[model samples]
Target: MLEQEKPLRLAAFDMDGTLLMPDHRLGEKTLSSLRQLAERRVTLVFATGRHYLEMKQILANIDIPGYLITGNGTRVHDLNGTLLHASNLPEESFKTLITHKWPTAASFHVFRDDGWVTNQDMPELLHAHQFSGFRYQLSELENISASGNSKVCFCAAHDELLALLPVLQTCFGDRLDFCFSAYDCLDVMPVGSNKGSALALLTDRLAISLSECMAFGDAMNDREMLESVGRGLVMGNALPQLKQQVAHLEVIGHCKDQAVSHFLQHWLNSPTLTYSPEY
Candidate 1:
């Protein structure tokens, strides 16, 4: 196992595949574990590719308080919903994204400062965001400015997205970053923006170091944050490539089994839990 571990003062989690079940809802066990962590004085932070508003809806009835890193790191907010940092894409890059001719079946979603927008009707997307009650407004993406825009996403079949990935990289390689938040979702963001960078910013603001942080994730979008944390917990259901790369870290049980909750319970109950992560 990877040996580096300091006292964990902060814990970051990715939503969909890492912390949430396949149905995109947080279970009671996980919620209780997170609440216990906060009670122990550990600062809780959610580092997700999800939008802040959606996250708010997901955690609505619960009393769990935490910071949020949204838009795959384009926006960072504190517990009070205060904006700590924001990253915007360049206008030309935004223009390129809006004007690009995407695959006919691909549904495009954009997160802007004003509101969320989509190029077509994607009621299917609502299934995942049901807990959050956050929905996107349909638009032709015309007459929209880039001032507050941060992320653009395309959703299609897993294989279709795989085929389109290379084309996107070839065209906007240096200008933006593309990552798979899910098998079917390809998300694009400004260069240098990601969960890890945003996590670093949050930690810095909180007077903490990455060496004292623990984070859980399950996809390519979670890569940088996993690599940057003191202890990175890779889910058993993680992307094969990601699991292979972070094999040195703990490979927990499948998320559908509430693996994150199990780990947290162990950590909380372990008398040996200290500056080392033996879980």
Candidate 2:
């Protein structure tokens, strides 16, 4: 049981398979849990690899208002559309990506403040959108030279992205951070841009301590975020390596809408558990 003096004040969720179910939709029970948590004054935040505009459409149906960490933490915004922070990649990094020895079958995406820009045509963009339903305003790569970008993404098979990571890291180094947000996609954003950093920024702004926060996730990108919070939960469907990172061995059930909702209801009703850092 958690000490009464230190209660959870915030809950951070990873969007894709963590919060949303296998069908790519939020379940009724999950929504109810969110409402219950809100009434208890626990801040709810959604952290995802998607951009704000893309996340808004899908989350519009929900009634709760909370902070959003989008573009894999490149930008942080509140529910009222207020921008709290953003980290944009340098122009040289973008230039380096465009000129890199990319896999012929791989496609790329660039996210800007106003909209998404991609050199590939709409068909290619559409294919990538299968993984993340982010709305984009496609542009030719030639016209993208002057645009400020927050992130660059490459969509291809896993092997393809793996083949490109070392080369990209070698060229850009500290200028960018790299990860696979989806099974077949590789994302590049400014250094220090990630869900954990965004969470830190939001927590600081809200005056919430790290020990009073809980987070949920299911992928490589979610690793740091899970490790950063007071109580980090990995979904039953998470990768083995990811599951090993959590301090608690408690296994939440499979990631159906019911599973997430059930766990939240139980946790909120249970006594807060004192956090013991594994690191």
Candidate 3:
């Protein structure tokens, strides 16, 4: 049996390669594990770069009661679809990005209590639909100059996104947070905003202590979250730098399917199992 000072109160999972399979589908094993965790009263939350609309489908498939930390950390919502909290970039930042000649096909997304708005044309909006659920409109960036934007995305090649980071940083500075959500997509949010901060806020509202929380991630955006949680798990496919920075090393399978579920089964079943570095 596992020695326990206290039972884990929460389990925050990063979507893409951490919880969902590469095809953006949830496997039966993963869903089963989630059900088990929920039954145990472990507050399961998702801290992902995806927005709520995009996350809803996956949540429906898994069928669990939990909070969502979407847009990296800009937006937080409850399982009942309540908007608990949100952070957004200033209008000036939006204008700057829209006016600037971004290498990739850039898009702007803004969220409020009701829903989100975007300033992309039809073709562009259709492309975004494949990734998120927010309604896309053809409002020009200048028209929404005073609008509050929750997140901005730039879609391009891997190397292209990397190259644009420095430029964006130089232009936006501490005004915005930037990271690649996928190989061809870069996510931007307000500074001082991230999955970790969102988790902190959610924990506070739920009256849960940081020490009682466990989080899983597999990307650079998840870095702060992994560092902030009590036990941060890094997936086997995480970047070398990300793996090196983790406080505790827990090896899990890749994002093919049920990797997280399998690991959790072993973990909860054998609490006495010790963790060792894979590298």
Using TM-score, give the best candidate's number.
1
Count backbone overlaps in model 3.
0
Candidate 3 lDDT tens digits, 102-162: 6555455555333555665546445434534445555656666456568877765667778
Where does model 1 exceed 4 Å of error?
Answer: 1-5, 271-279
lDDT of 1 by residue, 172-260 (tens): 87888888888888998899999999999999999998888889999989999999988899988999878887778778887898889
Evaluated at residue 147, the lDDT of candidate 3 is 68
Best by lDDT: 1
What lDDT does each candidate get? Answer: 0.85, 0.78, 0.75
- In the predicted model 2, the residue pairs found to clash are 2-272, 2-273, 2-274
Candidate 1: C-alpha RMSD after superposition = 2.7
lDDT of 3: 0.75
Q: For each candidate, how many residue pairs have backbone atoms clashing (under 3 Å)?
A: 0, 3, 0
Higher-scoring candidate on TM-score, 2 or 3: 2
lDDT (Cα, tens digit) per residue for candidate 2, span 60-154: 75667778999889889987879999888888777877766665477888888887777666564454344456656767675786446888889
